[model samples]
Target: MSFDLTKAETPKADDAETETAPEESAARRGGLVDFLSGPAGRNLGLVLALVLLIIVGILTGGERFASTDNALTILRLGSVIGVVSVGMTFVIAGEGIDLSVGAIVALCSVWATTIATQTMAADYHWSVMVFVALAVGAGCGLVNGVLIAYGRIAPFIATLAMLAAARGLAEIIAKRRTQIIRERGFVDFFGGSVAGVPVLVIMFAAVAAAGWVLLNRTTFGRRTLAIGGNPEAARLAGIRVQRHTMYLYILLGLACGIAAVMLMARTTTGTSTHGTLYELDAIAAVVIGGTLLSGGRATLVGTVLGVLIFTTLTNVFTLNNLDTSTQAVAKGAIIVAAVLLQQRVARTGST
Candidate 1:
């Protein structure tokens, strides 16, 4: 009987360990998933996706797909939208949206190249035109911030109104015509490159660097995350949610100004039609970059990769003679897929 009891107890002990093993394995699996859905993981996934796309491009188009020229073209095309996407990242990170960004770009560009600003620049310095563009962008952002933060208007309505107003104003200023930039220095300086890298690319890199530092390294960035994650809790914790919200919009506006300058340099013209549907492109890049649409978390690296991915996809499509309509469809599908993935990740993390 004693021997039988010992054997039975030993079996029970072994069974307990076996039961615990599954629990341990499940915990490890959960941890792995959390890591994957985290910022670093998301960026890694985007990088892999980008590499896969590159491989597909190479397979489909041979050396032409991997050419240095094509690479530069992707960077160049991505730069303007990429810059705008940076600002959009801030807005979306704060649980907000700015539909007016593209319109703001067109407005800033038109304003900077207008006879008034251009004449002032020639009489003074070319930098004045740049200043005006940035100012107009900041000013527009300030308005959006005020309306949303103080006026208590909804972000969608506020920004949507701005989208129309800004575009309308641009048309009014330009008389529905394209304002060709006559400042050769402005064009040459911005369009030129340093060490064989386009200045536009440099500008994009610099902006992304600054954005990363601002969002990840500063008190302002911390507060932004707090507010987006939970505004009421953030307020109780001593954050100025309203003011911070306004500042977010202003940051976005400043980004649009930078984008406007880049667009003007590249195309040598500022038209009301410039930046049409740009908001969609910028938002897509941000969403595809892995930023949560519902707000709280922000990922600058993801945003950059998202920009490159979309830009590369567009380039590949063009090289293959695919239509713009096809590109649009692909983008829509991507947005839906990204949002779904985000929701799934959130659920898994919660469970």
Candidate 2:
């Protein structure tokens, strides 16, 4: 009887262990699910995609694609568009869009390189030209914000109008000619490198860092997310939806200004044609970076990676002698695929 009791108790202990094993497994599964649902989880896919593209480029293009010079070139080229993409991220996250960022860059660059600003640079400080570019960009963004937020106009139409207007203004200012940057210090410093890093690359890093802080660490960022997630709800929550919307546009405009400076420094010329089709590039990068197009989500790191991916792709294409038209086709396909993937993810998450 004693032996029988001990055997029965041993079976009970085994049963308890079996039950606890499932519980422990479920706990780990829950943790993994939570992680996959988080932002980092979302970005992981994009990072892997980027890594795959790099591998493909290396395999296809050989040493040229993997060279340090090409790598620097990709970064330098990507920085300008990357900055613009950062601004676009905010705009899209706030349930809004801007079709005029490229045009704004053109306008800002042209304005900064105008005779008046250049004359100021010659007489006073080269920094004055930098200020002018930022001012023009901020002003353009302010107009877009006011129209969308207060005027109750749609973002698409408002920014479309701005696209035409800003480009037109740039053309008029530059008289349909390229405005060469002749300010020696402006050319040397911005076009030069610091500790072997391109100034453009440095500027991109600074802007990305600042944007991450603004979108993650500040009240403004939270409000922006609230508004984008649900405007009516945000209004009920005591957030000034309209004003905040306007602020978002202004922030984007400021980014364009900074990008204008970078473009001017890199190319040494500002033209109405400078940022042509850049709007599409910025939008593509933002979307690919895992930022939801329906708003309420933003990822600066994702956008940076998106920029790098696009830039690297372009570099790979160029190295392989792919035509511009072919690149356009590929880019369009990517945009559609990304949108579809997002939809699928959203559906899965909802379930």
Candidate 3:
């Protein structure tokens, strides 16, 4: 009974095994998580971009840039671009593009203005024209979807064709002239702000919130992501690839319509060339925000930040009296830089 060596040895062995088991398991788990998340880490670029923008804005505007008014201005500008990019994010994530967005926006603006000024004003139509304009956008998207999904056409070519067609339609209605509306209520609602905050900005937030919910929390979003990730894989998985692709275009069209309404409300006119080159801007915003151009993987918040980066740059240049051409050049350079940065991270893992 005095000091049994076997009992003492067994206790020591049990204690050693218990201590080592948890340490080894945690190490394995951490390694797996790190791999899944990737060494580059999502949104790292976005964070860096935001910091740099703030620094530049602070330097460029001096006290003005730091002011709340300046901040609101940045937000208002960013919001308009943000709304369009939000929809573009879905399309890009699904490996598609909408060249028709700019034209669609112009179309919506003219349509809404036509309704609000001509018939709705006299007949007391509470945004009936808005509904009609929305339907037009959805229809345009449906046509695009059919061609892309069913006809098996390339997305860029299909959307580029749609772009021309929609722009032509917008031209027909605008007649190459900007039609101004004298509706005070309409102008105030869109151009003016609620409690000093632009309605356009709020509208962007609403659209973004809806997009977030759709992409992150809904079944339609799941299908969109799956289709983007791999249409063939999605089909093999029993998901409706064709139908989803068609609907995704429709959704993008709907977003274009919404953007148009906001534009008309702000400007109180429908112009044929209102959204010239806006499709590129929207695409840039989506890409800068961290969405892979190849399809699949997107971040709603990243798109918002991307819009901010562009808008902030534009504002700084404008305040400094930079010409339009110069701003365009600068923006293009920035876009190239952002894309290159993303590509580097994508291929090399991390810096």
Off by over 4 Å in 2: 1-34
- Model 1, span 120-225: residue lDDT tens: 8888888988999999999999999999999999999999999999999999999999999988889999999999899999999999999999999999889988
Better of 1 and 3 by lDDT: 1
Candidate 1: which pairs clash?
Answer: none
Question: Taking the tens digit of each residue's C-alpha lDDT, what string does model 2 give over 62-104?
Answer: 9999888889999999999999999999999999999999999
lDDT of 3: 0.80
C-alpha lDDT of candidate 1 relative to the true structure: 0.93
TM-scores of the models, in the given order? 0.97, 0.91, 0.85
Best by lDDT: 1
lDDT of each: 0.93, 0.92, 0.80
Candidate 3 regions with alpha-carbon error over 4 angstroms:
1-41, 115-117, 349-351
lDDT of 3 by residue, 1-351 (tens): 588888766757678999999999988866655553442444565668778878887887788888999889888767756778898999888888888888888877776666444566647753665686688778888899999999999888998998898888888877778888766666666778888888889899999999999998998888888889898998999998888888889998898888877777766677888778889899988887878888877888888888888888888887778898998998788789867876765654432
Q: Backbone clashes per model, in order?
A: 0, 0, 0
Highest-scoring model, TM-score:
1
Off by over 4 Å in 1: 1-13
Cα TM-score of candidate 1:
0.97
